[model samples]
Target: MSERVGAGKSGRKKVRDGIEGAKVVELRPKQGAASDKAEQDSEDRRFIHRDNGIWRRKGDNPPTFICGPVDVLAESRDEEGRNWGLLLAWDDRDGHRHEEAFPRALFAGDGNEIRSRLADGGLTLGAGTSAKAAFLEWLASLASEQRARSVTRIGWHAFGGQSAFVLPDETIGEAGERVVLQTTEREASLFGVSGTAEDWRREIGLMCAKNSRLVFAASCAFAAPLLGLLGEEGGGISFKGDSRVGKSTALRVAASVCGGTPQNGAGGYIRSWRSTSNGIESTALASCDALLPLDEMGQLDPREAGEIAYLLSNGQGKARSSRTGGARSVARFRILFLSTGELGLADLNREAGKATKAGQEVRFADLPADAGRGMGLFEYLHHEDTPEAFARYLRTATGQIYGAPLRIFLRRLADVMANEGEDELRGRLRDRIADLADDWLKDYPAASGQVRSVAARFAMVAVGGELATSYGLTGWADDTPSYMAGECFHAWLAERGTVGRREEEQAVQQLRDFIARNGEARFERWVDAVTAAEAQSEIPDAPPGERFRTQNRAGWKRWVREDDGKSAWRYLLTSEAMSEALSGLNQRSAKAVLVERGFLLPGKDGKIAAPISPPGHKKVRAYEVMAAILGSDEGDR
Candidate 1:
């Protein structure tokens, strides 16, 4: 048995070879240590005395018991062995126990924080700087007998490693060995476990039946841990709609899968979108390899909203300079986020006066909250009569029974991975996802690669939900997860309009918007007939009919006779203007899209632009945009 020491007369023999009054914890090394190292280990564990689970130890000055009980548990180092720390265990006055890891860096400070942390954790240090310094020194001395020994490593977020699925607070799969979780500080509300598996499965889990959004959101939580397993990149799903539409409730449902469900925006498993860029990065790291539930898109700064979408979906953060002035790798993580907002990402970007890119759209797929059933965000209310009542019940149920399903699901995953190596598990998951996606895509045979990719993501969520159900954690039917996920995917696809040629569609929309906004004001009209056209340059001198002009002309417009012999308004744009209209797209490719759609009439030279002479201007070649741009033009101009 390990050596046990006591503090008072009942336990006293002598204080010889130790800090005076406290009984010497006999010099005994942990088993398996060499004689010399064993002797050293004994010294490392010196000065600790436990009295009925109370940690007490004497201070240096006056040889007094400055404080009762100082217990330092096992030491820990990061997996890379770069940072070292120790796990501290203590009991509060109420007999409640607590354990937390403190990095050595914390002790290197002025000792105030260490003492404060202990005090905050229910260990009140004795008065005086000596007591504080001496107490801290004694705690540091726990590492004094550092004989070279294999130290356990820690990770910030070790999920989906090649060998195991690990989390900062816990591991999902075989750890191969014990590893401590060393994470940055975050809010008290996040990542906390409460309630039981049965409680959650009975209440919130059962309520997910026939509820597509709830299941879809909850599945995203499960899918987070599987991203690394399936060799998938990080991304997210956004549920956007008006307030009281149950969007936040969906977020809370997803949040329940990971930990405690805080009231929306009060922040726990569900975080507010109102954070700085740095704060968002920290939040991402806090929820790494887990579902990051963000509430309220309206809260985020419009300018930063779209940028953060790219940031969260990209799986990394901004790099910073180390104190030494050298650049260090910025924090990176694998995260699956579920968000709720009054507006979708594209509209949010529009608020910032920016257009949403295709990649951004792919990274964060937006699904409308309205189910189109006249019941906001729900197809069937199950036992409830109204969506509001349903949402209220979910909020109450989730608050009671959250932070359990995650453990149950992860434990099952760990068990499976332990039996079959993680590699095999990953392969199995990939195969299942592929099979599920194939089934989901049977109707959209011509889906774009991007569409397929998004489909696979939704499919992954479905598979995770179904797997949880199969594990008996969710108590859901076998086909429920897939059906719910399908409902969401089809809704997103319909919102998107076309599965394939999304870029082409976007290009057409871009042109349409540009013309709609700029047509009359930016396009200079050409004077008809030869003499009037030649007189256009002499705007001040020419007759009113000949002096056609426009302010800041982007290009030109004219009542042109089409091949079909109908006179309609046509927009003419220079190569530069066309490029401007199709910013962020391949210039030539966008033009080809226009031609293919009969939106553009290419010249005989096979170039996008055709030669056109405007009044008083040189016959500068310009792209003749079809009158269809205006949708309908009858040469009234």
Candidate 2:
């Protein structure tokens, strides 16, 4: 048995002639001064204390742990008796130190509770690469079960700042306050003991959902096989699922792994790397040490699809800084994890079941399930106890999983992208998404619209990017020349693609055919109502002393006040009708009305009307013409 040390004690002890301490512990190395100088010295290793639940010797107060790793064990109790578990373990760097264990929890209840707690807490789980993979595998098993259950409505209860409950109230026995159980243990125990088959099924289903989140987090952290596709050369994993499936939560966890936040807006994207408050941008995502989690990707406009694709396909690229005098070529910010909802891809051919057709097999892929899965784990790992612990974990872990000789999972993703065409790959994605949605809807009826909208947005992004690529321009930006290409594709798809070759020709032909059958009179009336209004009226010259005068009219009446005490000509002036008639008239007619009626006047030869300008120098005719004829001309002149 390992010797127990008190909290206050501080001294070294002998371990096979090695040194050990209550706070700063050490062990003597076994050695006979021998031949080979190649192997690293075993005795050089040291262990220090840490306070953040990580392994540490008692004496050390700094955040840094010793070069050698230490183990962690914790304890908690609840009404169902004292529950204990071996939560985590940290192995030595070289795998040579003596194994260490600590009491995780102590139960104050009956012997039964003590026994149960001991049983639960006895397992001394390690915290290295293989352990994380095993945890993910276990989570996947739960996900498979969750996928099978069709029931809907899952509630998430989050505790922030100060909260009364640590574990679920239902699971706790009829004990007084102060009794607490580790959330994991409580959840697992309740899952095991649920009574009826239906109850058990529900339990199983929820477990699967929760487990999937954990698995996703673990896989992303370790760069496991299931997550290999995320780091591929031109490959990305998208989180597409119905609302409340924890899609955003998963991406948040992924971002946490990269020390990032999933936020929107210029400051969030452009300045994420500089502060904790800001979120990561597509540009910053590329530099992340681990998978870059992008959330709410479907919110991007059709114009942004190309740049998004470039960031995903290429691990690195360039962006123009939003900051003034920003350089043209900046480092690319690619994403390892991309998430969205309501993405729809439809190929007329696919719906028709014609594989060989030119455009029949459009495919829409839903967000990846892992997004929710990862998000769940993030919640569990961080809980409410530690602020930004997940972020710190990600900062340290990204280098391990994403840098240097990249993980195997990333390599697999690269392989898949290299072999699959865009259509084929997208089709597979669509099918997966459909399945996920079908599952989600069983629990949430309202989720369908939200899911579909997000799905459509995602599809638009993809199609838009493809169109931009064809145009020989790269990326999404408000000012990029290729920005509108993707938008055009979206507009085309929305209209189901017109039968005519040209949009103008289509409109003209549509009008012509309709008019030919119905004659010009009906068409004329329809145009008259929809077109801008027009009218004509007479105006009086300004009073002798004033250079200019104006009149305001309402309906069909002109203001003829009794104050004049004289008869005046009633000018038949146009009101709303000006827009249509002037639009139909030539430039000269349009200008004449505004100037003669005092609505607008020329200031000399070319200048516009101004407070200090010469009487005729301000030319207000063009301004009137522009206002009259420019109300919504589908055609740009």
lDDT by residue (516-612, candidate 2, tens digit) is 3332222111111111122111223211221332333211111222233421212121333233223322435444544553434355655332222
User: Which 10-residue window of candidate 2 scores lowest in summed lDDT?
Assistant: 143-152
Question: Per-residue lDDT tens digits of candidate 1, residues 1-637?
Answer: 1345345433454433344444444222233333665544555332444463222344332343345554555566655665577666677888777666666777776767666667787865677765666666666666423221112221123433534444545555544454555433423435567788788788888888777898898888877877766768888988988788889888888888888634432136677889988889878876766788888878888889777988898888998999999997787777788888878888888888777788888889988888888888877787899888988888777776678778788788767766787688888878877887888789989988889888889988998898898888888889989889988999999988888766788788888888888866788776466435554553334334324446777898775545764455678898778888888777788888899988888999887789987777888889887767556644324
Q: Using TM-score, give the best candidate's number.
A: 1
Give all candidates' CA lDDT scores.
0.72, 0.29
* TM-scores for every candidate against the unseen true structure: 0.86, 0.24
Indicate which candidate wins on lDDT.
Answer: 1
Candidate 2 local lDDT, residue 495: 41
* Candidate 1: RMSD to truth: 6.8
